[model samples]
Target: MRVSSYVIGAPLSDERFYLLLHGIRGTLDKVPARTGAFLVENRGKPLVSPPWDSDDRARAHLTERGYLTDLPEENERQLLVEVATALHDAALALRPPSFFFVPAYTCNLRCPYCFQPHEMHAGRGVYAKIMSHEQVDDAFRVIDHFDRPGALAEHLDLSQEGQGTADSGSVRRGALGLFGGEPLQEQTRDVIGHIARRAAERGATLRAVTNAVQLDLFTDLLGPDGLAELQITLDGMSDLHDRRRVGPRFRKTFQRIVDNIDLALARGARVMVRVNVDRSNADELARMNAFFLERGWGSHRAFSAEAAVVTGDAGRETLVTRPELVEVLDTIRADQESCLASYEGYAHGVLSRALSGRYPFTQVANCGAETGMLMFDPRGDVYSCWDEVGFAEHRVGTYHGGTLHLDHEAARAWLSRFPGAIDQCSRCPYALIHTSGCAKQARDNTGSLFAAACEGFQSYFPRTLATIYEQVESCLLGEAERPGPRPPTRTLPIVDVTHGRTRPPRDEVLR
Candidate 1:
């Protein structure tokens, strides 16, 4: 017998309180200094009860708190297999899969760092066809197909006790995401409007991932309650944004986007302005935040600004990481004399589970890429995720004849990716929490289906935890930090992008 692979030790606020951070499978224990020492001393080692030969009350206390457990190798194996199967099943039984509809594959801006080129014709090897009404029909047909009676009752929280199926009244949430080339384009307004009206009728919310270039044109369609969130990207300031998001200079793209943002805000739609950053534009982000503050956009309840790391184009995004962006933000915050309490009134929400349990999702594996989520392109091709948006090889199915022709082999591979399924993650400290990173990114980078891609969970996550909790402690104590010496910044070391330590076997990877 050995210790269970589910325990993390960290201070909640300071050295006085140590968090015995067990995840959803177990409970969290806030122990004192002595109890924390006992747990840390015995962690990952064979457990011994109190008063066996030595009178170790701390060990008994920790065990009683559920931080200490016995796990045999055989039992662990069997448990993993069952949990993986349960997770896979839960995928099929969740709220209606998120529908990411691509109206067109042609973009108005020609960002040099853009990964997916604007495919105008077949010669480009990418589908650039504007989605026909038939494609729209096919998308709805697929969505309807997944909404079997009593299917999502167990997975999504909105479903009733015995009601498994989602109907027009119970669709509480079948998230509708509008993606590029540009969903708000003039030509695609009819298709976008159709989706919005359908979502509204079905009691679902529609969130648009748009360029915000022509959002004003569709203000009539973006009814106050219909459009939930507008995820628009702004590089930095006007000149920096114009240089990065290259478009017709005569068009006044910057001012137009700002005006469109105001239109969405006026309509009560949450405006999520993702400030795309790289080494070049990283420094400019603080200026953008200042600009928003100067314009009083900070006071708007639905307005938010966040630093989003650019992933697709490496040449365009040199030295881009979330920490680097945060450093620049911190530097600017000091310069601008903004405090944590000052930020509380500003309308922006960062997805953090430590602060609020509710954000994007609360699960071992948050994304629906493998199970319920599916995307449809202009060419009627079905994909498991948005990362594989423009890639043809990753197409899992095709939407022809208003029917989804799926590839079971490809679908099952993604479905198998969970905490228990991946052999490498069995030993990971935060396996149950982090789950797998981008599956496509892992496979593309490491040529393995089971390789762990991002190491932020192990690398920067602890530091980030301290940073957040420390601020919370400070804010709670009502201690306004007087500017003297700037606090030292700790950055994460880069992990190997090629592959994680273990590849597992092909059978396990494809299982």
Candidate 2:
């Protein structure tokens, strides 16, 4: 199966892009004929079709015919030709990304859920020292090398057997992400400004994730006519958010963040709100949504809501079970439904599947790690996902001597850690749909993905399934009742980090 060039920009509109056969069954039946027919009729189309009803049928037919053929000459030859043609067409249609990591890992908040909290502490910084000007230059050099036509040519040559050409136009180049202990830190502002200026010089875009406390300072850097996107975190309403975020002045900090966000949006900068959901704040998330809607913030060009599973201490053993987390998620979803109908909201786990052809919210026995996004650290360590920050082997590369690049071998090694299948998950029908479980969490908790899936299946899967069952039952019984009054706003006890032990939960982390 192959995709057409027309599908490059508008993939959803051009259904032909879905034709790639990746071992899934009954895909052709689902593919729209208009797309398939368009490809077949287009004389210059590079795809080769076998004598079959659809691309899926053609693939199956080839595989069956090859398997049935007697000797190497007949079977291998035909199979090789078919595979080569499919790959060549795919290469032509493929669009590789140009991602960069701007050097800075400082963040202002010491939220319990963050994976990179080590970067913020005075002595034990998660990342090396703030990126020096030399380091910034090195980052630019690496990006420039990738942007060069020769680099693209080499990438294509290494990727496919001279089947396609990579041009400057075909490569999507943009600003590296603004990451830091706190990107807006006084020390890192210059680095952020330097990156913005450099991006303008090179005609690239600026994209960064921040807590938004210092966003006001960076507005000039965004400017007009520059590509920009900022992801800011606001876990819940002021009371609840302040409890979890634990800043010196919670109310003032949040207000400043909101003000900066408004300023950025007023200036045409794209902004996305990333709410890290945990047991404590899940109930308040809906209130937060209401907060956004009431302010008319939902209508902005770059406005959207993203929910992510909390990692680190938030994902610890005693905090809450998977079932409880799912329950929180359900409540959050129901509350936001009204707002979502009028605006855009995304759950991280479901969004990935929704964006891809993969099923959202369904269980999967196993899936490839390549199906997920890779988190690149400033020092060049590549993680399977953002949550696996502390694991050593998951580190894919480093930028010491020269540019460290990830290869197929490295990818395979990383993928090998996650068990593809196990009896418990395989027997469970949701396995293929949900894609097993999070590999990083599994490895950290159980030392293997399969074990993680199994444990998750036993511990959390039942709750998730039960929740669905309850929801379905509720629909049968009529509209489900809304959850009770918002839990008394409790202040979290500030753990003395100097002593390294958590204090008992309090009404507020701050006084």
Candidate 3:
């Protein structure tokens, strides 16, 4: 019998009693800190650890957690290859409930730190063209013909064991996600509405990622028949936001965005405010979160906030370490009125990630992108992932004549970019669950999709496991819900951190 090579033991940073077991993407287990010491004392290495001899309690615990298995060393890699192939096959067997269609690659604000290149954005003397109704019809027509997977049931089904749901197998096909340069721009309203109405007729969900500056112009589309939650951004207060998200196209967008946020909340529409933090506005993240708390938006059922470290070409200005980003979040969850603490960080976090579930890490395939999900960018091009949208070289196929014509070899290349292909991925301690973190990001940064793109998840993993433990503990202790109103906002002065904006050297404590 041999221990599985995929089982990883990550030491909890501040916890002396326990060590973390990242069994898979959706599973986390823990054993005593002494388990490591015991193994080290006995000179037993991972993947070849000691057996569950009766006298050892740690070994017994390990055995119960499937940490020990009866697999031969020589057959391990071969077994892993087969498991990965099964996972790849399963992901390709289905399509997400809704497709993320880019009506136009046009945005109102050309953010200075935009990850997208100049050619992807508008104002390049190119007109902002929204996807036509015919294009929308063609997209759905193609989607209807594809082999739809149960993946959409994870979020959109809204049904129980015996309950009935629409044939889209959804309370709505989940959502026909409206994404874009800016989906809410006045010119794109008609296109967005057409899609929303179609989704509503099918009892499917309708959602959008917008800038919110022109939200009021489309208030009629913010209710039951329209978007359930409009995802928008507010880098900081007016001065901070406008300076970074520069544009003559949208003046005073910061205040207007806030007003529209309030308007959306008042109308019973959930809002997701994405606050991208960098040295320019890191200091203001907690303050901005506090403002939301004071506005009572923090406690709203649909109000979800996400603080992502802004990543760019040069690593200098981006988040130096994941812990620094966590520090900002620590200040936020500290707010009594905010539920951010319970969530551990906004959408698709620990509890949510665990709940939404994930493939059991069979191989190197990373995210839904590598799967068969289809994204249609304007100009009738199709991509497996949105990040690859504007890059012509990554276009896996094209959408035309109400059908998808995908390059068989090119599409297979993505699925076959499995873990063993890259020694960097195959050799990682947590290669199983952290299979691949944005191959596109790695390709852009290091000129190879197979390059190690750890994204600092390993650095902050200890704390994440600890936080998940706390959440479970609190639940076990019968702690009543802790949502409460926060104190009113104080007259706090803002500190200037944007001088020169030349980022200091990144810390090496985290990768």
TM-score each candidate. Answer: 0.77, 0.59, 0.77
TM-score leaderboard ranking = 3, 1, 2
Overall lDDT per candidate, in order of appearance: 0.57, 0.45, 0.57
Candidate 1, residue 416: Cα displacement in angstroms equals: 2.6
What tens-digit string does per-residue lDDT give for candidate 2 at 76-95? 33433343334323422343
Instruction: Tell me how far candidate 1 lies from the true structure as C-alpha RMSD in angstroms.
Output: 7.8
Q: Which scores better on lDDT, 1 or 2?
A: 1
Better lDDT candidate (2, 3): 3
lDDT of 2: 0.45
> How far off is residue 356 in model 2, in Å?
14
Q: What are the per-residue Cα lDDT tens digits for candidate 3 across 232-329?
A: 77888778888876665775678888999988888777676766667778887767777877888876766766555656453465553445777556
Report RMSD (Å) for each prediction in the order shown: 7.8, 13.5, 8.3
What value does the lDDT take at residue 320 in candidate 3?
A: 36
